[model samples]
Structures are given as structure tokens and as C-alpha cells.
Target: MFLEATWPLAPFVGGFCTVRHTLGVSQTPFDKFNVAYHVGDNADHVAQNRRTLDSFLPRSPIWLNQVHGGRVVDINESNISECANNQLDADGLFTRLTNTPLAIMTADCLPILLSNEDGSEVAALHGGWRPLHKNIIKQALRFFESSPEHVSAWFGPAIGPKAFEVGLDVVEAFCNDDPNYKGAFVRHPDNEDKWLANIFTLARMQLLALGVKNIYSDDLCTVEDKTRFFSYRRDKQTGRMVSVIWRKYP
Candidate 1:
């Protein structure tokens, strides 16, 4: 069975989406559609299943060597094959053309997708705590030729706010950057230095800062929903899920 699942987040662009969250029965968390080659799943099986994924879309999803940074790659026909080698560890992807899918693999981190409302351009981003701290979403916003008003965004499943805990450093990262983050974290009186961070709200803060009005989020939690989603924080050796998107053609 294909382990890929569709995003429940609203207003999917022509080909914008999230893949299914699944576990490999033999491989613990890496059993199903573990698109991450670095996670120790069998390489042959990963390739075989990748072909399985190819059958669902018009072309291969341009993959990445995710490094949790804010750098974005532009994908075009000339670089599709070379990209497989020089994806050179980027955290986000953008494309103005159709047919070539731009995608990412994530576990607990947010797999973010952006598309112009008229459907001429699209992108995929990886946002965990580090990249978020570095303003990766902001980098993405700058890539679009259109104003934020003409752009729409979709956020894939990530760890829920309630389940996400951090020390004072995490809270300080945002607060130091912008005091507007004061509302995004709640201090834990009993825990002393710990705070609860709302990743969804964190995402919304950036999207709004760019004047993007159409934002859709999957309230789904990778940590809590063990049956359907994988969580690196929950399971260290977990298989990663692919959240992919491509322009649709008639």
C-alpha cells in the first residue's frame, strides 16, 4: 500500500501537497515511504519505492539535502539532473516552471509549500527550529516575484504546540529577533526554564509579516499522531515522510 497521505490543510494549489506519514514494519519507523536516504533505510528499497512515488506524479520530485538553513534553490530544466548531485544541502526550493516537482522530506520539522495564486510559481521549504530562527520563510517570501497578496501558503504536519517544549534559549531566539514573539510562547512556571512554543503560531507570524493572507495549516501533530505520522523527537530512528508539490498540467 502507498503510505502517502494528502494534506488536510485547506486550499491546495493545483499540485501542492503532503505525502502520507507511515512506518516501515520491518524497519521500525523507516518501514514505509522513508524518502530520507541518510536515515539508514535500505538504499535499494528506498530507490524502488521512489519509483513507486514517481507513478503518482507527472515527474520526479526534485529532492534536497536538507541542512536546516534558509537558502533556496531555483529548479529549471537544465539543472534537474545535476540538482540530484548539487542540491548541495539547501533547506528550501522554488520553481517557476511546470512538470518538475519541488519537494522536501520531514519528520517533526514543518514541510512548507508556497504557490502564487495564479499558479505560475511554487516552492517547498524545510522549517525546524534552527531554520525558523534564521527566517527561512522570509527568504522564501523574497523569492516570489509577486507581492505577498498574490501568494498563498500551506503548512504541513509538524509537532503540535502543546507537545513541543523548549528551554529559555528557544524562547529567547525569537524574542531577541522581534518582541512580537512574546505572544507566541508561554512560560512554564513549574518547569522554571522551559516554555511551550506554538509552531503553528510561529508559522503564522512569518506568513502574516509578509502580508500573505491565504495560509492553510494542518493542525495534525507528528508527535501525537503516532499511528499516521512519524516524529523524530518521538522516535529517534524514524522514517521521514515526503511533502511534495508540482504544477499541474492539462
Candidate 2:
């Protein structure tokens, strides 16, 4: 978990953001802590792992389908049952409801947790290259009444720029959106048609552009740290890590 800054929203209103590693009793690929259901891991083991995760929180988290798109869902107490019965097709989740953990799963994709000061609102985003190019961070912030300046963000573990190589089209997507994004990419030394994209840098640029002042990150690279994280780029059949954010009862 990335607990670097004294969680801008935790102290006042009792919300916190945390991440879980891929460590559980599931077999190879998933190994110990995979929380995703569609990843082909044993169903019973996945269920057990989810239960284990719930044991550490105030309540079960609201999990989504995570289509790597910019769709953000605002969850409240009223629709809690509906959300559970019908899985949401969104990549980002935010809530004002107390004790309802909003979670997003990721392997090599970036998991971002955002919250307002005093913990009145909190959100989590599953950011892959597609969502990043689409500016999902800005899209997620639109769910809250607060301005971007009043929000703080924490970036969970993901494939670092040195390990995340992308095609020229991705580079074009970013640069075409904004030329400032060009700095977030580096030409691959071996592959002429490929470039290394800095996911965190791209994310930071988006947040800052939107006027979000406080941003914290976990420097750990998922692709490089095989023991602590699961990387889709490194292992296509790997499990995903979950990052959850919620408001604690006062």
C-alpha cells in the first residue's frame, strides 16, 4: 500500500486508500493474493481471497467490470444492492456513502485513489493505457462536487516507464491529445516502432493540468518486482491486485 503522505483525507473525515498485493493460496499464476474473478483462478480460492480481503475492511468493496474506459460510477447507500446484484460496467468508482469500499483491480494497469480533504468524497480508478489516453482522472473528478484543487491522489503500483513499452500509435494518441505528453514517452533503443510510456508521468500531467495539487505515488514497479506485484506484461496469465478507498464511520 502507498501510505507515503499522511493521507490528506484520512485524518479529518476518516477515509483511507490502500492496495493489496497478489499474495494468496491460489495456484500458479494467481499464487497467493489474486482478487479478480474472471482471471481463470479457482472459484473457491478466489472467493476465499475476497473474503479474506473483506476481513481487513469495514465492509465488502463494490467491484466493477473495469473495461479500461472512462466511465465513472457514483455509488450511494440506495443503490448498494443494485450494484451488488448487477455488476457495474465502469472503470472508476466514487462514493460519499460511509463504509462502502470502492475498489478497482489491476495487474500492469495503474490504480489511482482520489479523495477530497476532510474525506467527504473518495474515488478509485483502474487506469490502463487506453483510459490514460482518454483522461480518466479528469473524468472521475467530475463525479465530485469539489474542485480538483481540493482533491488529493495516490497512485498504486503499476508497470513503470522503463518496463512499459508501447507502439507508436499509443505515442501518437498521447501526443495528439497534447504535445506536452511527448515528454512522457521515450523512443525504444531496439524497436523503432515502439516507445516506452511513463504511466505515472502521464497521470501526473493530467492531474496537475486539472488543478489537483497533492499527488503521491508508490515507486515500486510491478513488472520488475515479481515477488511483490503481478505484471500482465511479464506474465500474461497473472492475477490482479486490488486498490480500495472508502469513508470510515465517525
Candidate 3:
């Protein structure tokens, strides 16, 4: 039901990625445990699924109106109400407040959970290719009062390199940003004009370049793990699993 994030951080920081489970109410393509309402799942079913997930969380998560950009919202008591209403249009969320859970929903795009060494600050990012190319990870790290070396990051399940084929333009876009990113792509096995991109590697490169060292990642591939996850690339219309992070009250 949950793929808990395993990383070195103060015990107060908590995070996990939800997986599809038979117990949820979403039907057919959504199967079960689909918590996103914008994915064409039945509204009532989505609500029930969210409520069920909320039961395990300290507070209801602040869902984002993700646009696959670099914007990161600083979540605080002042704007918590608007964030709860899902009125924020951004791909990343950061907060220092205890019990305020931040969430990012995705099928194949990567979900990254981050926190300072002592767990005083935490953040969640939606790491689609567009956002990554736009330097979303860098944007989120800037919210931390701690330096990059004091930050730890955990990457959730995503479309792996073997299945994430892309065009020359995609490869060029990344390589143009930094030559180091060239290592994250290779010629597709079946198509010479296409390349298989490694989203995880690309994210790692960004984090490493920004001086963050304590990085951990899940090797699970959403496109290959049909039984445990949802994949939009595999199924155009599908449900979304959410990755959430928060710091418990001291």
C-alpha cells in the first residue's frame, strides 16, 4: 500500500509513495487506490481514496496544480488554506511547519522528497522531464536554510531508462544545459533517431551538481511494474499515485 522512503534524516521527517492496492474504490483503468481527481476517475471514488490515504497521514496533503514547471511554493500557515484547496500552480512544495504534509502526484514522472539534515525543513517535487530540464530541483533546494550538503533527497518510482524513449530534441535540450547530462541518454535499441533517457540519472546529476550528496532512489520502474504502479506512458488514461512528505511535531 505504501513504499516508504528510506533515507538518513532526523526521525521527525516522514515520507512515502503510495502504490495501487485492491482495497481502493477506483475501478477499471484506475483499478484501485487512485487518489488523483483530475485523471478522469470517478469523483466520489477519488474522494474516498484520498480520505483513506488521509487516515495514515498527520494531515491532509497539500495537492498542487502541477504544470511541469520550475516554480516551488513555500508552504506556511499563511498560505496553507489555499494550498489545501489546490489553488497553487507549481511543481514543488516546501515547508518548515510540522504536520503539514506536502504531496506530488504522478504515474511515471518522478516524485522527489527532500529534507534538511535535522528535519527542520521538508519539500516535495514533481520531477517530470520538463520540470527537470527547467531546474526544479535547484529551485526547491533554495528554500532550505541549510546548505546543499546538509540536504537529503529520496527519489520515488518513475519510468526507467529502458522504457523512457525520446527524440533527438529531448537529448539536445538536456545536453545543451550541461554536457554532463549527455551520460543520461543512449541511442534507443530499435530506433537510431531516438534515445532512451534515464530520468533518475538526470535528476541525480542535477542534485550532485547543486552540491547535494545524500541522495537515495527507488529502482522500481512504473512502466514495467504494472501490478504495483500506474504508468501514463503505458496507459494514456490512468490513475495517479501520490508521494508525500512531512515533519512530525516535536
Q: Per-residue lDDT for 127-182 in model 3, tens only?
A: 99999999999999889999999999999999999999999999999988788889
CA lDDT of each prediction against the hidden true structure: 0.75, 0.81, 0.91
> So what's the TM-score on candidate 3?
0.97
lDDT (10s digit) by residue, model 1, range 63-141 = 8888888888888778777985555688998887776777788888888888876667788888888888888888887
lDDT of 2 by residue, 123-150 (tens): 8898888987777888889988988888
* Candidate 3 weakest lDDT stretch, 10 residues: 5-14
Error of 1 at 227 (Å): 1.1
Q: Which stretches of candidate 2 lie over 4 Å from their true place?
A: 1-6, 12-23
Give stretches of model 3 more than 4 Å off. Answer: none
User: Candidate 2: global Cα-lDDT?
Assistant: 0.81
Could you tell me how far off, in angstroms, the CA of residue 128 lies in candidate 3 after the best superposition?
0.7
Residue 71 shift from truth in candidate 1, angstroms:
0.5
